[model samples]
Target: MTEQPDSVVNDPNNYKLSYRKLILPVSLISAGAISFAIPPMKELDLSAKIEVAHDRPGKTTLDNYTQYFPAVMVYGLNLAGIKGKHGFKDRTIIYATSQLISAAIVTPAKSLIAEERPDGSNKKSFPSGHAATAFSTAHFMYREYRDNNLLLSLSGYPFAAFTGVYRVLNNKHWMTDVVAGAGVGILSTELAYWLYPKMNTLISGKKKNNKSVVVPYYQSKGVGMSYLLVF
Candidate 1:
C-alpha cells in the first residue's frame, strides 16, 4: 500500500459510513425509476432510441470489451509499479464480488420487466447488463485509485459511459435502461467495498501477520513471478 502515495491510511474513521456519497447514485436510480411515470422523461427515452435507430454509428464490439478495461487498468497499473489502494488479491475479490452483485440485480430485473430490445431482439432490455457490468468495474477502478490520483480514478468513467451509449447505438437498450443499470452498478460496487472486510475476516478467522509480495519478471526463456517473504 505504501507504493500508492496520497491514499487514505487505514484508520477507524475510514470505516464509518458516509451517506453523503450515496446521493448521486441513489438519485440516478430514482430518476430512472421516475422516468417510467413522467411523460417528458418517457418521451426523452423514446427520442433517444429513435435518434440512435436513425443514425446508428458503426456498430463495433468495442463496448463488449471496453466494459472490462477499467478493471484491467487497475492490475496493469499495479504491474507497472503504480499501486492502488489494495493488493491484487483484495482488489480482485472486491471486483468479483461487485460483478456477482451486479448480476444478481440486473438478471432478475431483465426477466421480470420483459422489456423488449429496441431492435426487437428479446424481452430482456429494461436494464442493460453490459452497462451494469461496465459501471461496476468502472466504479471499482475509481474506488481503488481515487485517493491516489483524481484524474486516474476518473479515467474509468469514459469507458463506462461509452458502454452505456453504445448499448443504445446498437439498439440493445433504451436510455433509461442504461441509466438504471449504471445506478445499480455503482450501488453494487459500493456494497462490495463495505462487505470486503467482513468477508475477509470470515474467511481468514485470524489476522494474517506474515508478509509476502509477488513480483512478476519478464525473461528471454520464460515469464515467472518471484515471491518475496518479508519478516
Candidate 2:
C-alpha cells in the first residue's frame, strides 16, 4: 500500500512572520519621513536641478502616456476580478490608503518645496503623483500574485519602471520626488500586508497545503523515460 503523505503543520509563530515583513517597510518609512523633515542638503538640491534639465527630452517624449495609466490600471483590475479575492481585496485597501497618504505627504511638500518643474511652469513639482500611483499599483500587483507564478512576479518591474520614466518625461517631478514616492508606495503596501491579518477574514481561514507534481526524465538507448511523483 502507498504510504500516506505526512501532513504539514502551520506554525503558531506565523504572526511573527508579519512582524518580520514589517521591518523593511518601517525602516524605509523612517528614512523617508526623516529625510522629508530635514532641510535639503545643498548638493542634493543642486543635483535635482541638473537632473530636471537633462531629462527634458525624455519628459517631452513620454508626457502623453501619463494621462492614461490610471485609467488602464482601473480597467485592468476591474476586468481581472481582483476584488473577489481576499489577497487582492486587501491589496486594494492598501493601494488606496497608500495613495491617500502619499497625496497628503506630497501636497504639503510640494507647497513648501515650491520646487520649480523642469519646464519652470508649475508650482507643485515635488513628489510625482504619477510615480506614486505607478509604484502603488506595481506593489499591489506584486503582493496579490507573487506566490502564484514566476511570470506574474516578473511583470511588475516593467510597470513600475515605465511609470517612473513617464513622470520624468512629463517634467512633472524631480528625481528625488520619484524616489521618495516609490519608497512611500512600497512601504505602504507592506504596512497593508502587516495589517491584513487583523482586518481580513481570509487570514483567519484554515491554511491548506497546495500540491504539485514533479517529473524527472531520462534518455537511454535513444528513448526517453519519465517518472512522476507528487510533492
Tell me the spans in candidate 2 whose CA falls farther than 4 Å from its real position: 1-91, 197-231
Q: Write the per-residue lDDT of candidate 2 for residues 53-116, one digit (tens) a residue.
A: 6755633544335322442454265456533123323333344455555555556666787667
lDDT of 1 by residue, 1-231 (tens): 334332222663543447875777787777777876898998898999878778887898888888878988987898789888887556655776777777777777777878878788788887777887788889989998899998999999999999988888988888988898888889888888887776555645443443444433221122345564533
Cα lDDT listed for each candidate: 0.75, 0.50
Q: How accurate locally is residue 205 in candidate 2, as Cα lDDT from 0 to 100?
A: 47
Off by over 4 Å in 1: 1-12, 205-231
Q: What is the lDDT of residue 124 in candidate 1?
A: 82
Q: What TM-score do all the candidates reach, one by one?
A: 0.82, 0.57
Best by TM-score: 1
